[model samples]
Target: MDIPRSFTIRESTHRIHNPLDDAKLAVLGRALRPAPGWSVLDLACGSGEMLCTWARDHGTTGTGVDLSATFLASARARAAELGVADRVEFVHADASGHVADEPVDVAACVGATWIGDGVPGTVELLRRSLRPGGLLLIGHPFWRLDPPDQAAVEGSHATGRDDFLPLPDLLAQFGALGCDVVEMVLADQDSWDRYVAAQWLNTRRWLDENPEDELAPVLRAELTDAPVRYARYQREYLGWGVFALMDR
Candidate 1:
């Protein structure tokens, strides 16, 4: 029903759980150009930043479903802070296989495609909640360059070389799935640094506040190795983006 305590602690301060910063997120929203009162369904919507911000800026209303109770609380607070509490709703539930009661103008699974097992399955899941001609947004990472070996793949936090395709192949995936690639906003190196580096700081701060906690050792190890691993592998070899798709 909820994420692990250690996971929450490590990303406690993150507003948008992925590499997209505020500016890039806003750019994606603008590219989509959802009309006022358009409905959106966001699965694994960490902190509900996308839904809340879209509700504020685009006058859309949406529902965000996530398994993390802690993140849902933060999402609700963010909605209220943005004066969009009445427009967006956050549900504390598993996002996997969850479909909206009504078809929505935009259906999204950002940065958590595992909810549907992988990119293909996740697209199927999102399609179930999308109206005809509606948009589907998927946030995912692609290999910026081919990893030299298995160790390089692992260093980029991937289990195997097949975990991600290169950028062109990833775009082709949508076409293979019967969707047209309409738009995309990619994360730059600076955004990647912000996302990964902030996690280290959050872990460090939590460790400082809870030195005796059982998870302290785990966080310590992560903080120690994360930066070097990110700088050496992911920062240069991994790229992330949110792509807009529509049924052709």
Candidate 2:
């Protein structure tokens, strides 16, 4: 019913929960330029940043679904902080099978497509809640560079080489799925550093404060190795982006 404790702890301070930063997220909002009063549905909406921010920026209304109570609290707080509380709502639930009671102008599953298994299935799920001509925003990683070996693949946190497709292949996949790739915002090395390094800091700070906690040892090991692993493998091989698609 909720995310793992480790993941919750690692991204405790994250607003977006992906490699995207505020500026990039703004760029995405600008790119989409959703009409005023549009309705958005975000699945696995961590902290509800996208919905809250877009509601503020575009005068849109939104609903966010997530499993993490901690994140939902943050999301609600963010909505209040942004003065969009009335425009956005957050529900604590599994997003995998969630379908909006009313069709939405935008349906998104950012960085959590595992909810519906993978890209294709996630798209199908999102489409179920999308109005005709509405946008579908899918955030996922692609292989920026082919891994040379299993060590590199594992370092990138992918179980195998085929876990991600090359960027071109990924775009082609959307076409094959009968969708048009209309717009995208990609994360660069700097954003990746921001996302990954923040987790290290969070883990380290938690370990320092809770040295006696049972999870300390596990996080301690992760913090010790994450920097090297990210620098060597993930930074070079993985490229993540949120792609806006429309059925063709």
Candidate 3:
């Protein structure tokens, strides 16, 4: 099956697929309080940064699943680099309808809840793989402030087409999915800068290679114009975070 080409390309770069920073990731790892024997199933686990870090810091064991072969390779390489290769496995597979091969202490879908439709469906799907009282860490976007207009809205990278909710509604959606919010770690503007600005670097490189390519124009313009608008909209008016959940 074909995955989103942008996502696969983003994975090949080793930066986060979303606007997250080391501080935010540290918060996520600490929020879970992973233990030596604890196992975490990181669904749609991008480059496996969280898994590798958790294993190194907490001795946690886990598997990370993603559709991108490129991402899985990076995750494996990172696991080895962190000396956690034995503790984590990176699997290349579609995670939309997946379950853990074995029950885990944590089941997470960070920045990719769309794998199961949205927060509700994703939490339900992940819950099946979680042990009773186990933790589930889901990363998603929220509004820092209400958008001023459709232009402001588009600048934040949200589409009129998707079913994104505000933070309050997102939290409520989690509750509706049969989970209680136990903890959360939000990404500040600096974190957003890391995510959005890095894309400029990526897009610039892509443009340099495919100068005459049609899509390059739109992407190049997005790269040039996005930073200012993104900082104004997403960084100033929208926030994103990872939340810890449990079966209620």
What is the lDDT, from 0 to 100, of the residue 222 in candidate 3? Answer: 65
lDDT of 1 by residue, 172-245 (tens): 99899999999999999999889888898898989999999998888898888888888889998999999999
- Weakest ten-residue segment in model 3 by summed lDDT: 6-15
Worst 10 residues of 2 by lDDT: 200-209
Q: Assess the local accuracy of residue 9 in candidate 2 as a C-alpha lDDT between 0 and 100.
A: 89
Cα deviation at 74, candidate 1, in Å, is 0.5
Candidate whose lDDT is highest: 2
Give me the runs in candidate 1 sitting further than 4 Å from their true place. none
Kindly give the number of clashing pairs for every candidate: 0, 0, 3
The candidate with the higher TM-score, 2 or 3, is: 2
Which residue runs does candidate 3 get wrong by more than 4 Å?
A: 8-12, 210-215
Cα-lDDT of candidate 1:
0.94
Ranking by lDDT: 2, 1, 3
lDDT of every model, 2 decimals: 0.94, 0.95, 0.81
Decoy 2 TM-score against native? 0.99
